[model samples]
Target: MKYSARLRLLAVQTGLIASLGLGFATLAYSETILTVALAANPQMQTAAKLIGNFEKKYPDIKVRFQTLPENQLRPAVLKDVATKSGQYDVVMIGAYEVPLWAQKGWIVDLSQYAKADTAWNEGDLLRPIRNLVSYKGNLFATPFYGSSSFMFYRKDLFAKAGLTMPETPTWNQVAQFAAKLDDKKAGVSGICLRGVPGWGQNLASLTTVINTFGGRWFDQKWQPALSEPESKAAINFYVNLIRQHGQPDAAKDGWQECLQLFSQGHAAMWYDDTVFAGPVLDQAGPGVKDNVGFAMAPVKATKASGWLWAWGLSIPTTSKNRDAAWKLISWLTSQEYIKLAGEKAGWGQVPPGSRTSTYQIPEYKKAVASFGDLTLQSINSADPLRPTIEPVPYSGVQYVDIPEFEQIGDFTSQQISGAISGQVTVDEAINASQKKMTDIMQDAGYIK
Candidate 1:
């Protein structure tokens, strides 16, 4: 039934009065609650500890932490983001998400927040970090832990084989050493690489390998390059190397498994993210702490094709409490928190790659010993846009930046994994990957 004008006016007045009362109740009863989405990595541990300090400073605010495996975190966060469910005030992001999601307006821009807030020293962050966490020149996120890929081996194994890791090694040398160190009879596999399928999981490592072998994912005109000589050679090399000397459960190996293999002294070498240094150096977590060795990722035509990734903190546009979220984010990612983490934990636990200052710290310098210099050098040496000796159309070293990349990467990885498992030939894997990629590219309108 339609209301008379007089009745509508009464209804409006009543509703206005009720809404005002509800708003007052909301203001009175709302506890400053912030939920954060975290990744399963060392830097996340540091961030969690810093949250304690932030809580102490602002007791009224209650912060909740949600940590997921690295592979699951991004997808979960993105789902919430796309739906505007507002489950997360802060979501940990990577280099891949910073620009793409920000462009889509899913995350808040922090340029004004940084500039207006005198307490936060945005300029104090390392330049690489500043750029990595930005989208279209606006700050989109905060770096939790930054990383580049490197080779971590067992020193004892190398010594037993009469071999030593070089500051900068080559793929040929690495393969030879991997062969010599392979002792399946002793339960020690030669090399443990991330092989289980995901964009940032195995494909990230493999992309660098392909790049160093002079591969480009696309031509300037956006043609798929998976079937090219560079990618084919790189895929064949990676598949064969892992199949012959990598972990027995190579099909199941991701970053965590590979790290476990190396940290447990079951693998001779683990080529993965530099952030892994923190856990590997932890004596409590694994048995082979003292026996571990570090080196830059092995090269071919390129001196540095190692991947660059930063697990960062970003506020979503859907958040109702922007100021409260920023307060927590600022404190957790501040310089003091970084220092505190180093002191409370170990110097090795400090977040690396994000700050040049970390390298300058005496404690970290002493702790990392051989690895610090190589890690820093690798981080500095990498130029993601031009990762290989040849130029590529992509902006990422280990990834292509299109919206379709995650699906494409996971699918390509499964195909390549079939080759590694002897279910398909390398040539067959490449052909399948090429066809899938082309179809995706065409559907996404990347190519005609």
Candidate 2:
């Protein structure tokens, strides 16, 4: 061979070798990206902030979050998972969705994964929450945080008004208190309650009111009962209470908006999830932390009225990264992550209501000294099985457990929101909702 030809061949070989080396380098550094869909809430936001630790610990994996509002998150996740689209590796869901999705086999079972991970301490999880996200004895999701509904009032406002808040207040007493404390001229509403139209929004609080007022969604024979006298009375009271004394644009407000109004001192009282305690105390305006007082959900016919809920992370069966998803979930829901959140996000802001050990953490205990035990008590006391005073063929507190309930609740919320906004009367809303629910029940074969 010619000397020049030999030199050219050697040059080509070197270039090819360099190209091969570059490809190997790229492979070594490439990360497995995990797309996660999360509900937009303060607790979830805090988790997002602390997620940097997870990526740092697992350098080979990267997480991308798609945070969406409560109403939008549900449908987006449902559409993706139901279609078996591999759009997300992990999704944030609630106790309401867990069992239904698990039974349908749309979400991967985490029981074996959790069992194999002894360090994950599945037993440490709160029993109500654990059972809530399980189906047929299999753990399908692990709770990031759990909550039960309750009331939070401003101690200063109550004192100034010459009123006292009972540890377990009655709805009638709350109404009387609201009448006295309403100071719209001072830029404060008497109370803040969700009025936005969504199953998880206004209806959540409204359903509890209905339950406490001796109403059920259905009678023992599976007949629509929203038009019943008790249910209608509950609806009237709820709509009138908010219309008379709730925050401005009450019809537009949901849990997040109410949280803001109360935390910023724009509202004197709030009735919603216990999870609000974390953000209200640690991240709210000055003076909120010192003045906020907790109370059980106000009751009338029942002894307890709180509703059980838990926001958890689930691995979809459609995910190609199931193992990686479990690893991230196990870590995110682990005791270590809870401690990390306390250290990094301030102890008052750590995730609550998921684990027994979370309460045992000294910093967490001190941070939420006023409301921690009450949160646990509320969660434990909620009885989904017997939520209503009358016998019902469904199981749930703030919601009905069937898949059809979502559509039914959404339609009812729209009608109820119209009443709240004065576009319709309470009776009109109730009648329309009753008719709608009846049609839905008959269509779903729940009633014939």
How many residue pairs clash in all the candidates, one count each?
0, 0
lDDT (tens digit, per residue) of candidate 2 on 1-448: 6999999999999999999999999999998899999999887888888888999999999999999999999999999999998899999999899999998989998888998999999999999988888888889999998899999999999999899999999999999989899998999999999999999999999999999999888888778889999999999999999999888899999988888888899998999999988888865688776899999999999999999998899999999988889989989899999899888878866778999999998888888889999999999999999998888888889999999999999999999999999999998998898899888888888776
Worst 10 residues of 1 by lDDT: 281-290
Clashing pairs in model 2? none
Window of ten residues with lowest summed lDDT in model 2: 280-289
Which sections of candidate 2 miss by over 4 Å? 2-23
Deviation from native of the Cα of residue 42 in model 1, angstroms:
2.3
lDDT of 1 by residue, 177-278 (tens): 989999988898989988787888878989999999998778777888877888789988999999988889686789888877777778888899988887
Instruction: Give all TM-scores, in the order shown.
Output: 0.91, 0.96
Q: Which parts of model 1 have CA positions greater than 4 angstroms off?
A: 1-30, 283-287
- lDDT (0 to 1) per candidate: 0.83, 0.91
Structure candidate 1, residue pairs in collision: none
lDDT comparing candidate 2 with the true structure: 0.91
